[model samples]
Target: MFRWAIIFAVIALVVSLFGFGGVAGMSKDFAVILLVVAVILAIVGFISRGKV
Candidate 1:
């Protein structure tokens, strides 16, 4: 999931360079959402690891 975020970020950068404003914006939004989700999951995993 985190890797996907990085891929989207790179896609956004490439699309922005090509002048695709809408695509870039969408990709950036996706990247942000994925990054947040990945972080949350990571935190949950770390916290739960001590339980077992």
Candidate 2:
């Protein structure tokens, strides 16, 4: 999940560099969403580990 975030971020950077604003914007948004998801999952894992 985190890896996918990095991949999308890189893709957004590359696409923006090539002057594709629309695609870059979507890719960047996806990266942000993935990063949020990853953070949430990490927090959940930590909380669950404490219970175990």
Off by over 4 Å in 1: none
CA lDDT, candidate 1, residue 24? 100
Q: Candidate 2, which ten residues in sequence have the lowest lDDT sum?
A: 43-52
- The TM-score of predicted model 2 comes to 0.98
What lDDT would candidate 1 get against the real structure? 0.99
lDDT tens per residue, model 1, 1-52: 9999999999999999999999999999999999999999999999999899
Which residue pairs show backbone clashes in model 1?
Answer: none
Evaluate model 2: give its lDDT: 1.00
